[model samples]
Target chain A: MTTSFPMNAGDVPYSYSKNSHLQREVLDGAKEMMKEVIIEHLDIKNMLSSSNKFYIIDLGCSIGPNTFNSMQHVVQVVKDKYHDNILEFQVFFNDHVNNDFNTLFRSLPVDRSYYASGVPGSFHGRLFPSRSIHVAHCSSAIHWLSKTPKELLDEKSSSWNKGLINYIGASNIEVMNAYVAQFEKDMEMFFNARAEEIVPGGMMVLISPQLSEHLLKFFGSSLLDLVNEGKLDESLVNSFNVPVYFPSIEDMTKVVEKNDCFSIERVELTHPKSKLVDEADAKTLMINLRAVLEGLFINHFGSKIAKEAFTRTILKSDEVSAWMKINYKKACQLFIALKRK
Target chain B: MTTSFPMNAGDVPYSYSKNSHLQREVLDGAKEMMKEVIIEHLDIKNMLSSSNKFYIIDLGCSIGPNTFNSMQHVVQVVKDKYHDNILEFQVFFNDHVNNDFNTLFRSLPVDRSYYASGVPGSFHGRLFPSRSIHVAHCSSAIHWLSKTPKELLDEKSSSWNKGLINYIGASNIEVMNAYVAQFEKDMEMFFNARAEEIVPGGMMVLISPQLSEHLLKFFGSSLLDLVNEGKLDESLVNSFNVPVYFPSIEDMTKVVEKNDCFSIERVELTHPKSKLVDEADAKTLMINLRAVLEGLFINHFGSKIAKEAFTRTILKSDEVSAWMKINYKKACQLFIALKRK
Candidate 1:
């Protein structure tokens, strides 16, 4: 589906702005690596477009102070690399059209170095003019597929993910295959769009978090509990599948090879240092997850049922923490840097 | 002052969206003229930069449907002028940082021919990269001075417009001169900034309404009526000078001449055909006026007092209609098209 699924908008208690600390942490952890990647791989002389402007686009930039920080860092690194000060930076903060751009624009740093503009569209398609962008940065956003695969919702299909929210930790191999196929399609679309937008020799840096199978299972169980209690319909659960996919290193490299437009410059997997070690951490994680997924839940099951499901999940934070402690080793954050050929 | 005063936001009863019929009428009148002028003066070969992207910016583009219409018209005109079809259009919708960009983005035409982006900043300064923009359009926005000329706000200045909301009908020559000087300075800043942002052969289209001295007087009388009674403080009225300056044809021509960067291509003044000849029309006019001026009133006086004044104005719609019948001939909309030399 090309339809945009946005995060919670505005700065209410449960808004993405208030609950995006985990995203901030991921971005913070990637900054040094991003800087090094830019320094090592950025061909400043060739990357500058004829307009003498360096166009940097942040795909899937949600409402932020984090997007602002990340974009500013990119500008600074580019500035330091090209000491002549001849190049101007025009940073485009992009997200789904339905995203909270008002908050994002208002929160833009007053003394920002780059000229800021907001591009509202799905990144899976062409968002910018061909060969116009110089650097593309996407963090903690690549995992979201354009939409949940249709097979997961079709009753006739063997891949129907009934009574579950996602393919992660699914008992059905067909369900996993359907999700994997969707992820490959989305990545191909994403890479193809970026290939057209980025100029020759331009760079793209992506920070993607691997799927935490246990967390999805934990959240899925909450909905199943409601199903057992006859509070929610089993059919409703059957129709709802989270549109997220965390790719393995092999999965990503294979896609890049297939696109054949970008040369893979760097591939590294770093596990987040902080884990849900306690109930407090687990509660915070659940809240963050809700902030990101609540819109999807509300869209599918109505707000009342979504609220009940999230409340059930939050109440079982201790179990989530225990599950995380045992499975945290498997969770990984993937960093990939590519140069357009 | 660099502080941005936004138009009424969202689709509420008094929002600018609901109250901008006159603006739409004015724009409708200008579209054919805009097309003719673009056909005659647009140097397509020189306007296209090396990037082959035609950049267009709508300054003071409040939450749009009107701005969208206007920008789309501009893009269409340019496309028709250049038959090669090699150019890409990037349209920037700009307003104050506090503008309701959320509504604007959400309401954007999904099938628009050009890529859309929202730029949040005052247009009085440099907003785009140098020599990047090819066309700049400002409609019903130039009259808003950067701030109420500081002199009008200073109690010690002879130009202090006490007991009046604008210099439009002020009897004091000093008050008029202060407003005149501020307008010239603001126009100079506007032209200089556009000169840097717009390519050498770029075009700027402006639509400004001549100050409605009678309308300002009518609105001022309502506040004065409150002052005559003990309901409002005189000092508050003294501190409130409306920050709008509608320039005469000669006044605007002089500023364009002084800027010396653009060659004036066309100057036309058209009286809006629809007049407030009856109470119904007068009431509609009052609501439209409220949408445009309520933010300024609420900022100066509190919301209660502002509402009270607008109520009093609406209550006297018959008088307003009568007044408009006599003086409607004097009300003129000015259209100016300029091309960078």
Candidate 2:
């Protein structure tokens, strides 16, 4: 694949994180869905008795913007409905050591009126006071391995061989399953931990890059079509490694099913909502491909060379240069807003 | 000082996370107060009824048996109260990208019925769906940054010095303030988003690592005492690098006041429940740190060195090695739950 080594280290699937652009679109879409689910399901009123403290944690709190979104929503519910400080709020923002914490906390608020602290540890393990937390949330970050699932790298096992096979075509089911199994296990640890950490009736919201053939078709078909047209070379397209691992919505559902602590409240699989546009706009809209492209170029040429290549490609591509409008994912989706059992 | 780099990079105060060495004294003692507060101010039943589609996202979810306790409690409550998957639960397992996701997930149930996912992000910003999650629950994951606040690197800051000096001593107040500002912003964003994203009356619960002299006092007169006793080294203690940016509980309440969306439900700083003692052998226990110690040592010593040093350190001192215990910080500790406006 063209994506660089970081792709291997950070690979989950459909890796778009390195994309500096389109973040707004992804962020906006995820936020909107979350608000809808929270409002529809949980009644923040009487529940948020002005007299109780509320807790919320965000796992994989990358750059923490989404964590902020989740907590702000909870605080707003308390203030607007209860209109009192009777309910204390504690929001825990957590992520791996490699995460950009400085960026995460650089602009945090002081005044300590509401409790905020770091729970340093893996979510798979215990990271809380028993039954002390209320709501737990995370988004766009779970597909990563806590470790490399390194054992799976045995390369000797049928699973390993299947995983390592040349990219014959679509997501190799065997490989996908292996990856999904790991994803499932990762989630289990996360939920089980929450099971011990959250209070009854607490909620968990998860917004992730959903797998939709229709949306992916746009990515895949378009890429393949470009390759056929010679606008994109096999090497170039091959170099584009999607950083995301999108288990079928069904598989994702099954992964959740593995945990009894939380039940699935919703499963959404709709094309990501982006502004409508023409082919030209769609090319630029391929902003999520930045990470994909960078990783590719870096692997092919090295950072410096990759940087130059990325610039050249963006600057020269008529495919991207063509249209004058914007187009969002035809079917990127989200789901799994749940409550503690 | 020896704690390691970026104190909040998921390092347990003592060293690492372990379930075997739980000193129930702290949990039990804290529970007494928790029970009273449960009776006096917080009403879990009422809160549960009101909260729906809320999520409890735990930052720094660790591995070990204790991890699932919180979810287990919630499940029991649900079984007793609803006996159905009426609520949604999403367990977000999180930590550094390099954390042990495999191990963390190993302990999680693989039932595929629970809503589960991994959140690869930080808490200092938005990590959940915008305003969508009801409760933001985090236990023992704050106070530590995903890493140290970055401004400390500014040459002009003067707040940062060179060499060993960098490793020891509390981080610059300016850096802390920066983190606080970021944290407050995180909170503000949370509330603001809650106003828009969360349902009215959604709640948040958190169990976090707080910074309070009282908390330190519970173990010793001061951190110095522990150091003097050789329980912790002076340099090692100071070299922790990460700042336990525990904003005062009082300040927390005030900060919430400033927030337009959230109201304070309650904030209590109590010792860890002492009842959480070891019934097996029956003796004083320390913070559960062994299980996680390896990770800590490796984090600081770079694996090979860490492995040797860890072995040497454990073998070298009885005081440091006596199956270390965990004594939680008191003062502005646990927050029962809160509702967002």
Question: Highest lDDT, which number?
Answer: 1
Report the lDDT tens digits of candidate 1 across residue range B168-207: 6679999999989988998999999999888899999999
Query: Measured by TM-score, how close is model 2 to the native structure?
Result: 0.43
lDDT of 2 by residue, B95-176 (tens): 4444444344444654422344444434444444444344344455544434444455445565442222122233556544
Q: Taking the candidates in order, what DockQ does each have?
A: 0.76, 0.03
Residue B180 shift from truth in candidate 1, angstroms: 1.8
The docking quality of candidate 1, as DockQ, is: 0.76
Cα RMSD to the true fold for all candidates: 2.2, 14.1
Worst 10 residues of 1 chain B by lDDT: B271-280
Could you give candidate 2's per-residue lDDT for residues A1-341 as a string of tens digits?
11112221232333433342343345456666666666676654544444365777877665544456556765665455546435667677766543444444443454334555444345666665456566777765564445334323444544442212121244545545565666677667877888877766777876665422222334444445445666655555443433345555776677667787777777776555655232334435444444534444455435654454445445444544332223233336565678777
